[model samples]
Target: MLTTRHFLFFLTGLCCFTISLRAEPAQFEPEAPAAEPGLAFLLPTDQFLRQELDEPDDSDPLLPPPLEDSFSQVEPTPNPDTESLPDLKTLLRPRFDISAEWEPEADGVEMISSDLNLKLPLYPVFGPPPPFLTAGYSFTRINAPVQLDLPRDLHQFSLGVSWMRPLNERWLVRTMLSGVFATDFYNTGSMAWQFRGGMFAIYRPNEEWDLAFGALATGQEDIPVLPVIGATWRPSSSVKVNLMLPNPRISYLISESETRQQWAYVGGGMSGGNWAYNLRDGSPERLNYREWRLVVGWESMPPRTPGRFQSPGASYLIEAGYVFGRKFEREHQAADIKIDNSLLLHSGIRF
Candidate 1:
């Protein structure tokens, strides 16, 4: 049987906890950072978004504060130049991205999915700013055995807002709220709609470490609610250790230049979705698909430039991994079919 014990061990080894010395003192730049969407504790999509927001940038103007008191102590510094608000162009800029994934038939099951996402920045009347508005749509095609009797096509549409704010020099809070319609088109009533949300509190004592705690409402049958706890440790300029649930990864910088950089990472996580649909005779049913994956992948993207309001022109990612613990379940039924381990391949692009 597949379990979470191995996943826990894998997270522990990613960070050995040895790098203790603090880096040189640095200044904190005040700007309207990007918003993080989705539940950090449950979905791979949200995890990927967090990774993008945290990626090292060539023009990053802020660095860890001077070490004082204990490793856990961080004092806020005042920035006198942050009184002005962002311009209209920066507030209205939008980002667009698209991705596709495929998995070959294994034990009579094959799957393909694609996603499109858009994010729009918002202007604040005063103070900092409000959350960004996000919209997304995804479609999945499943090829299964005749005996399974499942829907061939599934769809999910979501709209939400995400925001993050600093509580002090050492703490940041992030939250997301979204409503999703997950169904097979045949089911178009309230049965197909569900709401999910997440809130996370992050502690950053320095530039090298970030500790986080939060909770998530997944709106799924198996695990409806979950606690989010994790930490990010950067021991050097080129390595990052992310010890988090659902998805955990360790990345190493491979190559870099003024324009673009590349990195390779090995990681494992959970992926799947839950949907509602109608049978031929008008009976309502819920389908849940779940899978665990371990993979190595490489990603390429342009370095972030300060005051660059728009999104990156383009980015690319490709990965392949071993997939196991795959299963399909039908609610209010006795059918719980297990799928054999298979190979997974995925590629994505953003612009």
Candidate 2:
């Protein structure tokens, strides 16, 4: 039902309206010319599971970087425009993200969640080196009305490796493999384990455009595998258009200085997770919750360091959104419960 309404369609309409009112035409000058494009910025849904390369170096040039909803970081690509590879030391820096989200009581339920993710670059003295080693932990607490049948607490722990290898001047391959344990902590076993993986071919014809095609395995019941078709288009120095599944957004540059930049964005996406738990009857079951989100947010980030590759600098974001199409389903049940739409608040800091 929610998919039919296509919340993403409405989000796109609203995003375009905001862009038209504030976006201004500006000259485009790319100082760096080339680096690994940021897929995390392009696709927020898989932010924690993947890696992105390089931070936004405001001085190095290229259109202003787009807003990142999930703050995923990856390894930087060696500039294809240059003959030499990027210095290994520059790519070894680590990036960290911390975020929290809340949905106030609505339709008999409320939820709060927090996440911590780290992206660390890895290298080997011999053979090819892996680009990144990522680890994350998440905790969620749900307060439900007496009538609801749900677990009060849930947790997820993940570890993964991300790799990016350039095929040529304009093409690159990025892939990630991760194992996740999602449970109520009471049900800690194979039943709680889930595997996620993804691979994409990215095409950066120039500094202003990036096109990616691939699929992501989410390990959820309702939609286990999600296709990844995404594009990033910078129409001007002040505006960026991101067309991607699960999360799509348009961002406008609000202000900028030599060391920092601020942004405003409107976007929407699918948000939910699945976990395993033991029922009071001693039966092991899986619970899946799903929803759609429409959000407007603001963020601030430091400029990219010159010459040295860096993850996105310490940044912060605050967002408010509408959550709809909410539902809870069980692994082998004939019936599901639906909840009324509600408002959500989210904020995060990354360093």
Candidate 3:
């Protein structure tokens, strides 16, 4: 068995990254927190899943972290402290995203889509590497009113586990593995599905800068495996510049009140996913979707309630972005639908 080493080596050299490239909203858009195979800018293996392990807000956050990042179609970055998290039993969060203005329909194929990601974090697990560890379960759904896909919907359910270990004081190793099961849009699903995930080594040489590189794999035919990298630099306490263009965001902390905190940033990343569809005549089929985005958003977090499991009150966001590279492909079937660029609006809340 070649294992995944050769694939990893091949991908290691593919650094021709793009923020204009889109992603497949496979299972979680992060809150990208998408480590979701991240690249997702939270953008992850679900990735580049908004690339969360936290719903980066690509399913991730640029200013503040959102709660979604489970199976968002785009990879985004959610701003996480990345330092230490207060001990908690679990965290329950959810998020949703919608894209519109798809133009030049494909043969009467309307081009608007929406997706939702519900993130469940099972905290309190012990770690052999990092000080703490946890497992994650994310549920996601994507919808589009279009042709070539039967049953009117697509679904993804995933289970994952992650370990964050620190090497010395400046290096960190974050590893994650997730298994995803998706319905064929028209049928009751079976265990036969897909898998995607990543493992990263992060260097936090100091608070002002961080660097990372890793391997991300999505067991899709068109892209079976690939590599990923990320770098974050904070010039000031409130300003962040990201070198990971695919899902990069320049963020600023606008204000901080005991009961409220606000942040904002702009970034972009890849988005897309693979889903099984049915032919118009009701036959089994599969299709792949890929796209890109430029996102600008603001997020606010209300005070945290007093408790280990208390709510962070509520966090909300308003976002606007332009999306491009909308393509529906099934190359072997010679069905390549090029979707027009569109503008999208987003609103989300974490309870």
User: Best candidate, lDDT-wise?
Assistant: 2
Better of 1 and 2 by lDDT: 2
Task: Point out the worst 10-residue segment of candidate 3 by lDDT.
Answer: 13-22
lDDT of candidates 1 onward, in order? 0.62, 0.64, 0.49
lDDT for residue 279 in candidate 2, whole number 0-100: 74
Task: Count the clashes in each prediction.
Answer: 0, 7, 103
Q: Candidate 1 on 138-176: residue-level lDDT in tens?
A: 788888876678889999888877666666666667777
lDDT tens digits, residues 1-351, model 3? 223563353233222211122232222112212221223364522422532444332211111232222223566543234223433322223232322122223334433333334344432233222221222322323334545443355555555555554445455566666676665546444422777667777665554666777876776777776665777776775676777645777878899887687988787876666766566676566667777888898988663321112334555666777778777776347767675676655544444
Better TM-score candidate (1, 2): 1
Q: Candidate 1: what lDDT? A: 0.62
Error of 2 at 148 (Å): 1.7
- RMSD per model, one decimal: 10.7, 10.7, 13.8
Ranking the candidates on lDDT from highest down gives: 2, 1, 3
Candidate 1 wrongly placed segments (more than 4 Å): 1-87, 124-127, 305-312
lDDT of 2 by residue, 25-48 (tens): 111111222232334444334334
Highest TM-score against the true fold, candidate: 1
Candidate 1 Cα deviation (angstroms), residue 75: 17
